[model samples]
Structure formats: C-alpha cells, structure tokens
Target chain A: DVKVTQSSRYLVKRTGEKVFLECVQDMDHENMFWYRQDPGLGLRLIYFSYDVKMKEKGDIPEGYSVSREKKERFSLILESASTNQTSMYLCASSRVLGGNSPLHFGNGTRLTVT
Target chain B: AQTVTQSQPEMSVQEAETVTLSCTYDTSESDYYLFWYKQPPSRQMILVIRQEAYKQQNATENRFSVNFQKAAKSFSLKISDSQLGDAAMYFCAYRKGSGGGADGLTFGKGTHLIIQP
Candidate 1:
C-alpha cells in the first residue's frame, strides 16, 4: 500500500508566522501536489512538483511556496501566515501524470491561524 | 480550461438505500478523465471511482458506480446500499489526458453526503 505521511495532523500558528508543512511518500511516486481545502471552494491546488527541485504554481499560490529537494518529500511553506490562510491542507502523490494514474493522499493537516 | 460543477451541495439518504450525486463539467477536449473522490469527517480523502471520457462503459466499483453522459458532460456517482461510513464530502474532478507537466486537476466545489440510520 502507498502511504503519504504528513508531519503534523493539526497546527496552530499566529498571524505573520512562518509555517512549514511536510509530506513524504513511501511509494516513490514522481508527482507530488499540495492543495488547500476551504468551505464551498473545494480543493484548490497550491503547488505541484513533477520531479526533484522542480515546482509549478497552481490556482492559489499567492502566499505559499513549495520545495522538493528529494523524490519522496514535498514541503509547503507559508511565508507569512494570516488568519485567512487557516484551512485544511492536503498532500497527494501519484506515480505519473497524463495517464490513468490516481493520486494517493495523506491524512491532511489542518492549520489554524490566530 | 476545464471546469466541474456539483449542483447538490448536500444530500441525505437512509441506510440500505441508493443515492446519486450529480456532477457536470465543461471541457473543450473530447478526451479527458473524470473522477469522484470521498473525504470523510477526517482530513483523509480517497478516490471513489473514475471514468474515462473515451470509454462508453460506465465505471463501477463494488457498490459505487458512475453514470457518465459524455454528450452532456455529466458524471454522476451512485452509491447503492448506503452505509453510515458512506457519509462524507464527495468531490468531482476533471483532468486532461494530455502529457502531464504543469496541467493539474480541476475540481468542483463538492457535495456533502449524509447517511441517515
């Protein structure tokens, strides 16, 4: 079974604080994605990385950035957390894209900014 | 750009009954992929079922099946014998089958499914 482990299940941070959400996959997938879940908006992609040290911005990537230094790990960084950024963050990994590949998601991290 | 729409924001069904969640999408490309994902009360979300645009056969997985209408761009998920565990937020997503690089998935708002016991 493919497992994507997120470092924190819940996180609380104050405004203007920097936050780091880590995601590591065990299946050695080549594609990784970070998404934020908000009420009525569904899961909006924040960033996606196709390979090591490669990244691309998604629909909502204003206050977020990503780092993929290795094949199994993808990190989402909130440069300056705000109250509006409080939402559920999800991490997913897939073997490859452009085919019938399905994304395997990790137990998401719920972030609350005060 | 492709867009997905889920008309029903919330749906309720008694246990052991059948419930179908409505999903419609718009895409210019003829070949693509549609998916239904389930997210429980917890944060973990998983794929429920998937249907290919080119295939005429509707995809089915156990009690979960999809009603794919290509001409109308509709993909509805029908869950038979709904159980308490089936209560979750269901999301409809669309993705282009072209070479995957920067083109990610486009997801709809999602529908909340409630199972009444």
Candidate 2:
C-alpha cells in the first residue's frame, strides 16, 4: 500500500499570510501532484511534478507554487493566502505516468483563511 | 486537451439496489484511460475502477463494474446491491496515452452518491 502523508489535516491562517502545505509519499513514485477541491467543483490540479526540482502548472495555478526538492517530498506554497483561497487541498503520488497509474491521495488539508 | 464531464451532480439510490453514474469525455486521441474515483466523508480518495481504451472488455471490481462505450466516449459505473458505505463523491477522470510531455488525470466536477436505507 502506498502512503501519501500530508503535514496538516486542518489549517487556519489569517488573510495575507504566507502558508505552506507539505506532502511526502513513502513510495518512490516518479510523479506528485497538488489539487484544490471545493464543493460542486471536484479536484482541480494546482501543480504537478514529474521529477525532483521539476514542476508544471496545472489547470488552476494562479496563486500557488510548488517545490519538489526531494523525490519523496512535494510542497505547495501559497504566497499570500486570502479568504478566497480557503478550500480543501489534496496531495497525490503515482508510480509513473504511462502505466494507467491511479493516484494515491493524502487525507487532504482543509485550509481556512480568515 | 481532453476534458471529462459528469452531468449528474447528485444521485440517490436505495440500499440493496443498483445505480449507475454517467461519465463522458472528449478527446481527439485514439488511446487513453478512464477512471472512477470515490472520496468518502473524511476519508482519502480511492480508485473504484479503470478502463483502458484499447481493451474491449470493461473493468470491474467486485460489485463495481463499468459500462464502456468507446464509440460514444461514455463510461458509466454500475454498482450492484448498493450499501450505505457506497455513499460518497465519485469523480470521473481522463488520462491521455502515455508518451511524454503532459501527464496527469483530467477530472470532472464529480457526482455525489447518496444511498437511502
């Protein structure tokens, strides 16, 4: 079984604060992803990294950035958190891209910006 | 770019009955993969079933099975004898054939399944 561990299950931050959400996968998967999920709107990809130190913007990457300093770790940084940014963020990892690999997701971080 | 669509935002079914969730996708590529993922309340999202484009046979997992219409570009999940535990948000996703460049699942808005006892 693969484990995608998220640093925080629930987070609360003030507006205009810089927030960091961390994710680490035990499996040495080659791909990692960050997503924002909201009611009515499923999981929207924010960022994805295919290799260490390599990242790509997803469908919605406006106010977010990602860092993959290590193979097992991927981090999502919110440069400036706002009330509109409050939503559930998910982290996922996959063995590789081509093998019909299903994403293994973390428990998710419910972020609240007030 | 490929896109997935789950027209039904919510569905309700009785326990011990069967329910089907509809999913359709648009893609110009001949080869790709479709997936159904479930996210329960306060639980991590998990894969329910997956279908490959080239395969004629549909994918099934226990009571969960998929109705794959390649020509129609439609993939629907049918759960037999639904249980309370089956209640969750089910997402339909599409992934292009693996070669290089862009690689990641394109997801639909998702359908919320409600099981009635």
Best by TM-score: 1
B-chain TM-scores per prediction: 0.96, 0.96
TM-score of the candidate numbered 2?
Answer: 0.96
Kindly report which residue stretches of model 2 are placed more than 4 angstroms away from their true locations once superposed: none
lDDT of 2 by residue, B6-65 (tens): 999999999999999999999988889999999999759999999999999999999999
Per-prediction TM-score, please?
Answer: 0.97, 0.96
Question: Candidate 2: DockQ?
Answer: 0.68
lDDT of model 2, residue A9: 97
Question: How many angstroms is residue B91 displaced in model 2 relative to the true structure, after the best TM-score fit?
Answer: 0.4
Candidate 1 off by > 4 Å:
none
DockQ (Cα-based) for each candidate: 0.70, 0.68
How many pairs collide in each candidate, listed in order? 0, 0
